[model samples]
Target: MQEYQLALKDKRIAWGMAIAIEPLIGKYSGDSIRPGENAALDWNLPAGVYRAKEVVMELDKLLEAMLVQLGEPVNGDPAVLLDSLQANLAISGQHASLPLGPLALKDKAGAELTSQAVRIGEQLVIWAREINAEKRALTTYGAETLGALEFRSHCYGHPLIPEATRLVWGPLGGPRIMQLYNEYLHQFVLLRDALLPFANWEEVPFEIKEHTEFKGLRFLEPAREIFLTQLLGKKLTHKAIVQYAQSVVNSGLTKTGYGFQYRLGTVLPAGLGESAGTAARYLLKWHPVQTVQTEETRDLAAISFDYEYDDYYAAPRNEAGKGTTVNEDTLPVSREHYDGPSIARLLPNADSDRTTLRFSLEMEGREFTVDLGQLFRGHRFLYRPHGNDNAGDALTKRTSISSHRAIDILSHAGLVTNPDEIHFIPTNGNELVQWALLGKLYPENVVLLDKGDKEELEAAYVSGKGFGTQFLVL
Candidate 1:
């Protein structure tokens, strides 16, 4: 595609973070028989789909007298509450996630005293915020009980801020992180609204603390991350875990900028669900491959595509000029309140001394700033954009991300000039049209991920510098 669009304006490469896991309920079988317990038409017909593991052995001895008071796995990890005791149990597809007796929205002694005196039983995080009624501004957040780490304040109505969203779990050790509890975010929004589906639970009934964010859109990839690892304790794969949460969502609606792009699709491409401009709550857990074993299941109903790239939203720069910098330590696209005092003082080529000019936008992002030598004019970025990466902060820890044609600047920032949308940058080996397009190129732009590429951008081009994992599986 024009030699990958001249390797992202030439010079600047190296990028990593390649997470690919696929599998969706490998052996699902919920709610054994929704139409009254015992006689489901003598196993005949009136309805068909079900899988609470076919009534988990007839609600396994009253589910230990109703979750023996619900406890376990805040990190102990032996699969607790079988997914909050499977929304009041009742399965029948092939196996067992069948608890089915308390949470139908209260009753049964208020859902078995909310799984025993207010979940004194640990793990059920649930942050999933989205804000923005008009311009409130939060947009997206995650943690609906996914390796939480910390939360507390009667347990939650607002206030989790793990630095405001970017906690994609997969590795934790000791002290975990969850304090929040408000009846466990209201029994996880009543077990995520009684498994949704009642015409989408009256659409938007809200109280506040209730939340969830899953993406079972399953375009395919997730059948063996571990296969229901004892009722979801690990072997994780919410579709490579929400594509790592659609890579941190940049969906500002079109334009070369889907940077942290991840699609969910059930509606709300930019309509901003929950009856507002941003109450936020995207879900899409579709099972069927005849119940998820994978292989040809594309009705593709649930899809998420916001931030449709402004069309000319910006990034075609090349107003023609000079802009040099062999990387002496600039990194300041405007820190917080900026118009132009930071970007290392600008210098379209301080005084020339070469064929046209040199380059260096060094992939910045705090606000905006990009000239990078105006794309090296005609000479064609010398030796493939020029050589870059490890921009001192974000770009997935920098492993492989050079520049010259970075999937055409990430399909022109995500305007998707095709190239299959370029995703999967294992440090910099390019495989699906070749990866390496880092987070948010604009929606305010988001970089500074992990950090490492050739000693963090050759020590910031010779001294600019930049800078863990155990396992929580997700």
Candidate 2:
């Protein structure tokens, strides 16, 4: 690599190997272009153009082979033509990235344990990309370095040779394939570390800090972020934020909490400075823990559960609940889908506390749990409606919020979106006449009484009592 860099300039080069890849018509450099700039740059050809004649000759023959494949004559601007061909080859034969499996948590001995009672760091695997080009593919250049160029381009995330130059020079050489792969792997690892994603709560990890996955929470949208900022623009609370989250169904709670200033009593910024109130990336987790303490609470044979696929018939040899049924079809379709996983909220002998909500799914002979609160903690911010706050009677825009229920009130009262911000608040049973001045329902009360989504309510009620798991509708 070092030797070729010294003499790469001033060589009239034909760059590229395939037919469709348009050749870079001008000189090239390590200088990456700006966001909107054109690809062409005014490059001064480098000095050493002589010592590479032999490899360049071999490139001429390779060009002939590529031309034959394209059914085109090998007679034009060699550098440009060859480069165009290589680009086309790349487009047609692009390599694919491999799929990453669910992140795992395992003991030093590699045993998977329940999240409620375990410890371990999350594990990640890195894979390398393929780089298999041909020597016979090089054509008409003074230096045949197609392979070397391929490896170098990927390593730098920038192309080494201009498509035009490669036609005349590619077959000469490129960076070591092994070395390039290693560098790519190292950089990707660093990039992943920097991203620091909020956990996917849906997976129901077997461990706490290690394999936590959020089930119902999805990425908080920018629009919702703005709405939340408007709602609690004065000061934010993690609690009110969680309440607001119930409406979105699959979404997160803002990680923001009240921040205090000497002048102000207890306050939090919309999102400190440039962040717009949504950017304090943190370490968060969610996982499930199962207990086998009592007789009735344990898995049972007498009360066999029904699902789309597979059935249970047997019980443990002793008193403990046990079964040997296997079915892949019953897996949770969406981590947030409030259907079967209700086991955490249903089974008579399930959860220990009212605060716990469980998302369940069975995969590969193992049961998984996704907790709502755990998922909320993983994200940086929560969604809040902008317009409403406080108990109200009049149709004031700023004090009232926008919600599935409140939408009717705001629309009928002619005060929707009139305020700079709005927020959604879950409805609690309350009489509007007593809470209002006009002797009618208050605007906030309108939403509180807007019982439109009955199915969702029914599902939540079932999940909450049936399996000791509750779904906060958001």
Candidate 3:
């Protein structure tokens, strides 16, 4: 194994293999260009032109292969065609960027498309630049001097890479699990060092920072760093570690109570800046050692007594309040009868002439009808009847409605002919309201709600509880 490892270290041999992966290495370099640009920048480019020329030849072959696959005859010779452009560059010192089209060809699917042309073109440019760079380096520096460079550049024999390779190519399973554990372990160590000063306090105003994953798997969106920050000075807390753990768990479970707008399955937690700070502050307020202990004890006591009480009460009573063969099935179920209109009857009247009556609905299991007029009564700044020019209710236009619920309510009311026409603006402040507002009854029209909802409405919007259902009704 040592000999093989040492054999792999031969710079000449390594360089030969490394040249094949040049594109992968240069994937992020500034010199990357499209296939058309590849031909234009062939000669008089840099020290890597020879390797880049080789890559261009490979690209032409690949393009020819693709054309053959598509049943298109390979007509023009790319080398011959680019000869003039290459000459123009040397003579003119400035060349026009030529756009090579039809480089990518694709068959479109419904509302989606898959193409390989751009990817292939990019790969060609990267490989060419990388191969050229490596060739230049080998020629400039002797083989003995290039050994360390080859080893480090290729990252050969790194402890983690071997393990990663084992996981990727080994017969054993759970390499990913191991890798994740190591990543999290490293993160915890970093976090521990950061929080070492405040690790002894009972409670500290702590915030979790989000870190982007610079190694391993990447995200379409850059991930944020997560670590607890001491908001109350630099003081350490006795519960700092516990609070940090709780915050980590909480962030994992509820996305730090920012809700599920952006939840990922990675064990490492993430959070938004402002919202995460708000959540951390809220958590720290009740996250002391005493608070956690008290809550736990209280919860345990409540569970114990509740179970005992339930067992005692449900202990199969008869004429003497003793266990009996006549079971608890004989117990009568209580039903509270309502003397008012049923929910179906109280659903917003489709043809009601009164503006308020058109939007009012008495939901099932609730005693009162939800009156849109009363709900928005004096608070016209936050809501209004649609199509009304009330200046006080002018703020309604700023609030967004949920497209999903809007379509359902409109369809139920016989108002919308095409449901797909209803679109929700994700950028609006009411985006949360749109997702949270689960209406009890459908309606023909929707009332305009403003961005500045009251605290009660805001709470309902967050929890999807209470008469927040009414927020979506017409």
Candidate 4:
């Protein structure tokens, strides 16, 4: 048992060493060498190459043993790892070391090292991104749940769960899950920050932000449930909410050229019967009439017209059977009559053309024309003046504003008198917290749309029920 424990300790060290060596080699290998600099003068090329090969081989053996000991089948491809290592080593050996050709050898080694370092760094970044995605998936579905699933599958003697998943969330997965997650985050941040210099040197764009930090906690499942229960009552299911949200997203608001159109509408209680409540009107079909007002007129150019006389009106016909051409002297002229104002004297000035969107809706006996474009700009919900012309851009920009502030803006415009009566358009998961906050504030009246609601609505439409009876018209 003592010997087994020592062997386990050695394997753990080997695993840790492999993780540490990845970034270390990637960083140093990519270091920039000045034009006159020699980075490999003391590298002992052949000896260094031999040691790297041995270290790689030993790491592979140790990792395999460690995985097997943990009852997890090895999933890493040895060939891919070997290829990466071999490529880097080959780059380093491109320069032959000779006593007489020391400078040539060193220069060649330095250049090749820089090239090889870049390739390693790129591969590292790709791996980091993939691992981060996996981490997020784990976070999305809690560690406990994942562990339980893996443990159950393993006990059933089925390979339903991936080996990595099993190793991470199986019987011994509790502390290791957090340990691995934290370790990966730390390594990712280190790598991301370190690569900044290399990115600048290579003129490549790299995101410096640490995006792996949890954001889902801001709008937890319980909060979602409470919001839904309050707004939808006990009659609506979670699936209904998701379906509504998805239907809104798939509504093709962008393709219809509807611009930014929204309505303050009400929906009947979940089992109240559609005939009893006011149906939400489809606002996308409402065309925005463009009214142009000429604020100023400017003189453009003098207008002129050319006229020809008939053969009978001409002086006489020549022998060629053509009427005699009338010159300024032979033509009869009429006295020029000046009207009150010449139409040619003034033209509509392009700079003075003021175009406005004219659209109005009447709700609860109150007729109001909403300048959505103006409202969005006034509230800084949209930074670009033309952003409102595209429904997708406008919706995306609106997410920048807090849901509470958005409601306030609508209230000020008289579009939202009661928060409970307003059904906000569906937004993506990134903006869930914003809309969720409003749902919490006015729990009874506000219906927040989610992706699932959209999906449910879509399925209903596919059944030929027009926007799905489950979805509230908005």
lDDT of 2 by residue, 1-474 (tens): 011010112211111111211121112232111121143111111211111111122223333333333223433324444333233222122221111112132321111111211111122210110011233333322232322222221222322235433433445322333233223233322222211221322221111011112110112233344433533243333433322322122222223221111110111212111121123323222112121123554321111111111111221111111112212132111222222111122112223322222223332344443322222232222221222232132222322223223112212321122222222323231211101111111112112112324443332222211221111213
- TM-score per candidate, in order? 0.22, 0.20, 0.15, 0.17
Q: lDDT, candidate 1, residue 19? A: 19
How does model 4 fare in lDDT? 0.23
lDDT of each: 0.22, 0.23, 0.23, 0.23
1-474: candidate 1 lDDT, tens digit per residue: 011111222222222121111332222343211232232110111112122222122222222211121233232221233333222222222221222222232322223322322232121111111111111111111122222213222323422223211121212221122221222323333333232211222121111111122111111112222222312342332233233223222122222211122222221111111111111112222211110011244322122322212332453322111112122133221123322111121112211212111112222242222222222111111112112354444232322222233323432432222111111112232211111122113211112212324343333332211121000000
lDDT by residue (tens digit), candidate 3, 1-474: 011100111110000001122332223222212122323211111112122234243223222221122221222222322232232212122221111122121211100111112223334344433443344433443333322110001111112333333432344323332332233223222222222222121122222222222221111011212222331222323223223433332223211211111111111111111121111111112111110112233220100000111222233221111111221122111124423221111122212111112122232333332222222211211223233323333232212233332223222321122221112211132221221121212222223333323432332233211122223221
Model 1 regions lying over 4 Å from their true place: 1-61, 64-301, 304-322, 326-474
Clashes of 2: 88
Candidate 2 regions exceeding 4 Å error are 1-99, 102-175, 196-452, 464-474
**Model 4 C-alpha lDDT per residue in residues 306-381, reported as the tens digit of each score:** 0111111232211111112222222121223311111100011123222123223222344333332222111211
List candidate 3 segments past 4 Å from native.
Answer: 1-245, 248-297, 300-418, 421-448, 451-474
RMSD of each: 21.9, 26.9, 27.6, 31.7
Backbone atom clashes (below 3 Å) for every candidate: 109, 88, 20, 16
Per-residue lDDT, model 4, residue 401, is 14
State how far residue 22 of model 2 sits from its true place (Å): 31
Span of 10 residues, lowest total lDDT, candidate 1: 465-474
